[model samples]
Target: MLDSLKVTVLAEDSVPYESPLLGQHGVSFWLEATAANERRRILVDVGQNPDALLYNIGKLNIPLAQTDAVVLTHCHYDHTQGLAQILRAIGKRDVPVIAHPSLFRPNFITAPFFRHVGVMQGDEPADVHAAGGCLFPVVGPMQLMPGLTTTGEVPRVSDFEEVGIALSTIDANGRVVPDTMPDDIAIEARVKGCGTVIVTGCSHAGIVNILKHSVRPGERVAGIIGGLHLVEASEERIAKTVAAMSEFSPSLVAAGHCTGFRAQAAIYAAFGDRFATMGSGTVFSFTA
Candidate 1:
């Protein structure tokens, strides 16, 4: 039986990812979480370009048929754009697509003053059929696979995270609605002795919230991998984040994607070598 899980970073902006796998822009990550003698692969987000998504998958030597499930952090094209090409690979593989149900909404990417640039142009697929088909539409917290579960919409409880950033969508009725990014979710894996590894995307709800909500009040957090959304964060916010992270005492901090280089540097400065870099191709083995 499976006694451990392995994680692989398929695509991202930093680390050793191949530029030719996908266009230089956009974010996509492929994670292979294995346990027992079987392996299950997950596409955290598909890149903006279909070709890059396919190429990256091939370059990584990850078989398309082996993808067990596809989880989206949100509906943004950068996160879900690759669904089209993926659907063509396995020919309607009945894999479960996990994410907040709101991801399927129409005009989900419409934001004011930046509609053209928010979601990648020409990246939207006409339908899920064109995109890959997902069997289970997870709206809240639930066990997705063995030792793997999704942390449904994270609660926003930190004041330091409010740096006056606008993340919302404009409705057809001319309503400018605040974007809660309800579709945001994180994958939590329990590692034997090592504790829990939280794999987050964008962390739109706030990384602290994602981490806090993913585990019980007293459970130890072992490691964190993925976007911290600290690219434009103020120093105060960063300080608060660092302070909160210090409590987790994670063995490693593999930060990337929307995590600004400056923020990554700051994290490294504070945590020293405990903070490591993660990108496409980076892998971590966990023992149970």
Candidate 2:
């Protein structure tokens, strides 16, 4: 039912080319899917700064008013901070905001520095409604469109892919506990003839694990894009991840944001020509 898909990087950590696009320490993607002569525009994340996202949208000539929905991969501030601004940009249209139920939980990064890393402080639910947004909190796998679905809560089955020691969350008793990132999710698009294309954010739940939990048996993964969360990973762990990814033999692997240069290098060394350069303003298109 899906004929084509186009993904434009709206905000990222870097912009490699000579363009007017703005860059930020966050991630956002403009996803457009076409099926049966109908087109759907979706915003994957809003990034940390509204100005950056708005600037890039203008530079890229994206119509914010046409956005059908917004999907948040997790509750991280970098991904959820710009939601209000984006809603304001969309005007009076009540856009659907899809995400996991635990996305609003208090989260923090305790390692490098004890800092709050959850969504923006204040009444976010009210903010969404005031900005004309309908929140769809999902707990399991659910379809967003004809051939597009969310990975839901990814299971950590891979031993090598750790959630990292920096992530922590507040428990019900007001105790700080390790955040397993159960709310971490990704977008899965089943292209008519190109197989599945997986789009992720930080991959805090692990990329390989997300793939395993989302992809069906015998379904080939055509490509993978977005953050791999391997910036702070060990060499051994990176190697393991590369090995697991190699098994899928994806035609394209475009990674950026929190993926880190070291992990990207390893992935490049492994995938060679299949590894596409990724950053802010990068655009990728696939057609059946």
CA lDDT of every candidate: 0.70, 0.87
- TM-score, one value per model: 0.86, 0.97
Off by over 4 Å in 1: 15-23, 36-38, 106-112, 116-126, 130-132, 162-165, 171-174
Question: Which candidate number maximizes lDDT?
Answer: 2
Question: Total clashing residue pairs per candidate?
Answer: 5, 0
Residue lDDT tens for model 1, 1-288? 225656666667754645444443446656666566666677677756667667767887877786777777776666666565666675655566677766755434343455532334333434454555654656787675677777877777877764224656666697867666767788888766677888877787788877778767666667788888898888888888989988877777888888888889889998898898876667777776
Clashing pairs in 2: none
10 residues in a row with least lDDT, candidate 2: 117-126
Candidate 1: which pairs clash?
Answer: 1-36, 2-35, 2-36, 83-132, 84-131
Q: Give the per-residue lDDT digits (tens) of candidate 2, residues 1-288.
A: 479989999998888678768889999999999888888999999889998899889888899899988999998888889698789898855689999999888888876778988888542888888888889999997687889888888888998897754788989999999888888999999888888999999999888998888778888888899999898899999999999988888899998888888999999999999998677789988899
Q: Which candidate is the best by TM-score?
A: 2
lDDT of 2 at 89: 90
